[model samples]
Target: MAGNVTVDRTIVRAVTVFAMLNLLVTLNNTPSRSWMYPAGLGALGCVLLTLSVLASLRDCFRPVPTWRGIRVLTYISLGLMAAHCLTVRDLSPRDYPPLLHACGVIILTAAAAFPLPTGCVLMGTYAVGFFFVRLQSLTVGQALTECLVLLVSGATGLLLVALVRRTVSIVSTRSDLTQQEARATARALAQARERARWDGLVHDKILGALRNAAAGDSRRQASNAQTLAREALAAFRADTHSDAPTALARKLEQVADALGLECEIDIKQDQISSEVLDVLEAAAVEALTNVARHAGTPRVSVRAVIGQAAALLIISDRGRGFESQAPGQRAGLKTMKARMEAIGGQLDVRSTIGAGTAVTLSWSHEQPSWLTVLWDVRVFAPMIAIGAVDVILNVGLGLTRPARLFIPWLNPVLAAVVIGFNIAIAVCPRRPRLGWMLAACCVPLPAVSVLNLVTYGDAGWRYWAAGALTPAVGALSFRFRSSLGVSCCVASLLVLMVSEAILGRTSWAPVLGPFPVSLGVALVGGMLRRGLDGATAALSCENVRLAEQVRQAAGIAERNAEISRRRTALALDILPMLELIAGQGPLSVSEATECRLLEAAARDNLVAATLVNDAIAASARAARGRGAEVVFRCADNAQPHAGLRIFRSLVEQICATIGAGSSARFVWNGSGRDFIGTAVVLGHEASAIRAVVESVAHSGLLTVTCDEDSVLIQMRTH
Candidate 1:
């Protein structure tokens, strides 16, 4: 609808503007007394054109427009303007410029089409309009000149319009390509995360169980079975959201709860983008999973904060930390660092053997400052400026013999010094140390420059000499361990050598003496002042380090204080579990609740025990309907002594509560140090625990053997 309206408006405006221009020409050319008719017609035409242009603009801006409507509108406007031009030719009150008017109308109409062919159509229509105007006004040479100007104007306008349209097309295409890339990357990340989840489950559960079974530890074997169920739960939770950011605290709780490990999280909602959150969450889970598998640590804390311009995330553990930077030992740390950088973050880590480890990730929002601007200026700009000066001075002074010999030796030495300084700073242990390193670096080049100046009596040698001494004197003010001394001596010696060399050689003595003396004196004097600044800079570095150490020490103390408080809170939680185990009196409600938790915490985990029980009961009842021999048994060897009673009670309660009429047998047995038993649920409820356990018994493993939900089994044997 809007497209149709815009087309109408453009047609109206084109007609109106063209008529007004034509009527003005007629009035100007005809007798002033009789111009009223032409002016009135022109006024009417202007109104029509204005209305049409507006309607056409409105139409083009919207999404829906019928192909028929577009064609009808375009041809109607073209035909109307063409008819108007033909009727007005040689008929108005004055000579009419019908050609220019018609061209303008055609150009506007062609624009209404809105695509590649728009420009070509517009050019062709304007050409016909131009021919009409030229046929009316100009004679011979004037007509030819007018024709050239019209051609230039038409081509220039269309070329500009074409360029603008194509540029927009290219930009839109690039934007679509970038969006596709992001989508592809997101899909790959999702697949990788899914695989990691399954791998983690297998490692914690099946592998651990098999390892324990081989190690001959009955406790670990039972523990691994429970661990398997817990890992399955964790994998399920992680798979819940393939792309959305999962809460760090929630994910840790699920996995830690499964492994019977305690997790503490301090994360804020506004700390980072959702993308960063997902990355951190995955890394945290993986780290905790490793701890559960190897560290033997019962608890860990994960803390995260959004600094002024960076996001800081820390995962700390009170486990056996390894030696810092030990070869091949800290692959996880490397992985964590890589993850941080992938999200435009930084990782700073501190750890100690036997104490603990803190993996801190700092993510910057802005680009690195050095990379953004300063590094280029500090390193490249100077080299460029120096190179330009060297090229000009060396070429100009090559005519002199001494300059040829001296500059070659001096240039290489200077180049070596600059390269070495850059390499040293880049490889330096600490970034701030670059200040002193750069200052120290300034001394050597100046010494080489001064040596060359003394050996060769070329004025061009003065360029290298002066350039070298400047950085040296400037570097000394940095106040790190008498930085000025080496450069100062070099400058002083150059001054002495120049005085001797110039006094002995009288040929170019007048030209070189003044410059060498002035530069040498100034350098020596500047070095004296910098010697003091160098001392201050050295002291400042030490002070800064000490201040930093104090700040860090305070942070550690504060964290330790917080840890102590959390430990106290954990102690309060564990108190109920302990009281229940003591059995001094009837357990309190809280104590009874904690007892379930304590039972779960005793081995790999009992958190998944409830789910395991549900699945077992469901599977067994289904299997026993076939009336095959079957038994649901609690294995005595699953856990020894104390824990054996808890597992037994749990199994017995499950059997009694899930009652179904079926004939089955229960057997009690002891294997080595383990109290084990088997309940055989037979007939219709053979796999069902209720039929097997007609009487109650307390043990760990509840194994149901049945065929198609129907079976028969031994009533007892222990």
Candidate 2:
């Protein structure tokens, strides 16, 4: 704020400096034979300069509210200079008071135009005083010329100041807008860099291990490793790449290739901006990901278009689709929907689990340039069309009271249709191109009206008044466009003329109706249309939000259900083995039933736990393996404990179920007899593996692998 004040003060000083310079130039141009006149003029210049400096300083500390007194003082100084210029007898008529008087007038004009409060008043008053001092020496012609020149100069200066102010405002606004765009671009670049780093590290380590396993003649191990490797690779690759805003279709193609899925892209290029590209990219990616993961289909098609002031993107997969409205079924789908909305776009999904899924994203480009033109045309087009139609119908039913009474209502209806047509064109899925053609049609309508007016005088006024309502009605109906505002202004002027004709001039009353009725009709129609349009837009936004919420809720529920099913299967397998063990006596030695139950329970529990662990490991490996290095190791610490031998048996069974090749072991010297601190290695597939390991780690006994097989981690009983 202080900086702004400082800058403002600098601007005022610059203006004062320019004003003083112009004053000096005026003094130099003024001719005076006597040295006294020149001397007096120089003194005035010095005094003006001194006053300007002091005013600038004072303005910085605190602004002066009034400049009346300062103005009077400057006027007194100019009066002395003017007197000197007037009384110089040695100078010629053109050189003496006339020329000098013109100079004084210019200086005074600059003062008035400068926007310097105290300075302008002082300069203006001084100019007036100077003129007053020379008043006795001037003739009537000279005085008139002085007044004329002063008026012209002041007007010119004022015009320049207004132009400067407008230019500054425009430049400042543009600068601020550019800065905001720059900041946004920087943020996007940062996100892209972070994704690239994540992908690079995940791919190098996890997939490489899978390749080695396959080459070493371990086919069974290779297949299992490959599945984990593929998951990791997919995550890494997906994380690394992003869709460029303007080339969404291209990005979809890249993603399809990476996933080894077939994809078709059909998109229009014209009028495509980053905003449109982003919406399409989001919709296409989500749809394609679902197809790859769940559709059980190989092919996807994407189509995009820009038309009729709207943009559309559609993605369809030939994979298994899901229930259209099942609760908790589609989180990915819901996400795609939310993205479309933020940009004022809409998304609709159609799917059946067996058939395939199709997703459509649509949005209007909402061009400001077009809106302005549409507004203008909307107001006048229907108005003129309705008027032309009105004239033809009115003439057909000439001088009939019924025709006159019904025509007003009919005129508005036809006008409304014209407006509806424009709105349809604006909101249509296809881009509208009637811009030039609309202009062409409007050109001759006014000429035809003028010809009718010339042919029939008072009768023409009635036709004119009726025709005026066309533009007025059109303006009210499609006032969303800028064209409507201009049309309204033009229509208002026309109505004013009509009002004058009907009420002020009784001569035209026979041909025209009352002023109040026309005015009221125009006002009410415009307001009504505006209200309806606003309500419609608000409702559309609300509906989209509600749909998104419903989709999200349904998706959450479905995921929860899938988790429950998996847990139930594991529980059923473990429950029977536990019951058999309980049936045996505590001290049963080598009992076959007890031994079989223990073995079976261990296998069942280990298999269930292993499946869960491997799935988690695979998911994490996939995440880290995307564009990065990964490693896996098995620990040699699988042993049964006396008290919890079931738990130890479970670990061994789990290791076998998940396969042994992906494990790592570490030896660490401990002060105690407990070997639980031994390190066991997981995978270098995904960074998420760290999270899985940490989650399962217990204080008494657990796997801990850190520092590249050098350190041991285990659960400590404290």
Candidate topping TM-score: 1
Candidates in order: C-alpha RMSD to true structure = 25.9, 22.7
Show where candidate 1 strays beyond 4 Å: 1-41, 57-122, 128-153, 156-191, 204-225, 228-247, 250-264, 270-282, 285-301, 305-312, 317-321, 324-356, 360-718
Cα-based lDDT for every prediction: 0.43, 0.42
As a TM-score, model 1 comes out at: 0.36
Provide the TM-score for each candidate, comma-separated: 0.36, 0.30
The digit string of per-residue lDDT tens for model 2 on 1-718 reads: 1212222333343334434444444444444323435456545544654564356335434542233323443454455555554554443322334234434533443353235464356455554554454454555454444443343334333332333344334444544454455355434443332322222222222322223232334443344334434544344334323234455567778768856688888878565545445445656765775677787878888888865478877778877677877412333444455456545577888887888888788888553211111233343343344434433333332222223232344434443444444344334332123432332333233223322221223332334333333333333323343344234434444544554454444433322221222232333234434433333333344444544454344434433443344335434432332233233223233333333333323222222222224333343233232322222222222233331332233233323222222443322223325552333545442233344445445333554556532323453322
List, residue by residue over 1-718, the lDDT tens digit for candidate 1: 1222323333233323333333344333334322322455544444444454445445444444333333443454465456555655443313333223433433543453445476567556755655554566445444444344334333432332343233334433544454455455544444433333333333333333333333323454345434443443433333322345556667677877866788787876464556466556656665676567655587788887653456667778888876776512333444454455555566666778887777676766753211011222343333334333333333223223344344565556565555454344333343336545564445444335444443444333344333333333322322222334344434444554565455464332223222322232233223322422333343344444544455345434443444444235334533333322332333445443333333322211121222234434444334333222224332312333333344445444444433445444433343433324444443343344444344432332343345775433222222
After superposition, candidate 2 runs with Cα above 4 Å error: 1-85, 88-105, 112-118, 130-263, 267-283, 292-300, 305-312, 317-329, 337-357, 361-718
**Model 1 / residue 318 / CA error / Å:** 7.5
